[model samples]
Target: MYGIDVITLVSYDQVQHTDEGMLSLSYWTIVGAYTVRGEKNDTGTMVDAVLYDIPSRKMLFRAPGTSRIKGSSTLVNLSEQLRTDSLNGFHLAADNLVTNLQLELDRFRKKVKAMPESYAIEHQPGYTGGGSLEARYALTLLVIGGFALWSSRRKEGFRDKF
Candidate 1:
């Protein structure tokens, strides 16, 4: 059976402060975890992910599409569709996050613009999370690896075919 998982956007950061700069964002998502059993290959699981920018509503990164169909060579239609559906769910979540962040930023800017110069409206150029892009990538890899291992172990002998 085909299933879609809804991923929530947990954390967000506005990386730049120029009038034309974009908002950098990070969040956790779980594309439907899958467990498949078939001839030859017993079981497997996969997780898909995507990263996006809030202000620009742009997709910054996406994990390579993956499916772990170990046995039978032929993929069951439901599993195939699950992959597409999961990706679509992620896209929708990213869009919603952008909309929410944009609305909040716009409101904040309006409030600041209405204030007098005495109330200095200072824009910080950078607000880092202590983790740079490279660090973030490494962290993501760690998370993916952890999950793959966890899922594999959750179901005995479910060799990771990712």
Candidate 2:
């Protein structure tokens, strides 16, 4: 089959973070237009195609532009060529996308590795509930004192006297 040879792929992009927990793996496809000229024709119509991929960055399908060649010997067979060229573009796009994703994941891994496994808490209860009675009594007294102050402030409208 004789058809146009056009190749295209998605462009480079940054690692996107979305409001949802998961990040977005969005992609935009690029298409090249070519004129499928026959052995005797001076010019051929332009053909364009856009391909789509799944979330896993695998090609799902493609949507091609209109074809404007209808003749016995015009060599206007474009479906096969479109498929071939589009596949090539898809591979290139996938490779680039994977490289970028790997770089991003590496950064994340490094950050996680640098983080501390356990963080220290300034004040916490004992593991076996064996806290000192004096500390517990102090906490209760503090709570009661705070409540009294809060009640007094509420009764006075928390404002200066006129």
Candidate 3:
């Protein structure tokens, strides 16, 4: 098993489907059919995610996300279209869940900072805190330092020549 300190449980909270009846396509021409129409389907998905400490079984935070998808499909392809739309709705809901989870995590961190006594936090031995400088940032600083040195040397050379 993979080593994990916390576990996240995701569940589908709600699912809704609506049939909007036939939608007319007036602009398109059909060879055999006099009128072209499609059935409108709408699907809504809601997902909930809960974070918990594996060892202590303490609830950390909860996040919820929702999504809605509406599409029109011919009678022949209605089933397949509905299935694809349902999957898309779930995907969108999951994306929203990730965004909400990040926001909740930030709020949780603030809460922990504010009320340190309420939660027990511990770090493993040999744990060190540090800041990381990105490679692009470091390269930019080096280039700036090199440019400044070159400018100063150029000025010095000009003064010596005069």
Q: Which is the leading candidate under lDDT?
A: 3
Clashes of 2: 0
Instruction: Give the number of colliding residue pairs in candidate 3.
Output: 0
lDDT comparison, 1 vs 3, better candidate = 3
Best by TM-score: 3
Residue-by-residue lDDT tens digits, candidate 3, 17-119: 6453535444254631233435678888999999999878899999998998877766556678788988899989999999999999999999999999987
Please provide TM-scores, in order, for all candidate models, with all chains considered together: 0.28, 0.27, 0.61
Per-prediction count of colliding residue pairs?
0, 0, 0
Query: What stretches of model 1 exceed 4 Å from their correct place?
Result: 1-75, 115-162
Candidate numbers, best TM-score first, in rank order: 3, 1, 2
lDDT, candidate 3, at 101: 91
- Give the alpha carbon lDDT tens digit for every residue of 1-162 in model 2: 232122334343212111211111121112111222332211122233333332235332332322222221112334454444444445545554456556655764565467645222233334444454677899999999999999999879856655
List lDDT for all candidates, in order. Answer: 0.42, 0.40, 0.79
Q: Which residues of candidate 2, in runs, are more than 4 Å off?
A: 1-75, 116-162
Which one wins by TM-score: 2 or 3?
3
Query: Over the stretch 1-162, how does candidate 1's per-residue lDDT look in tens digits?
Result: 222122323532221111111111111112211223221332322333454544446543343222233222112334554454445545554565556556655765676578755235333456455535777899999999999998878776554543
Candidate 1 structure lDDT: 0.42
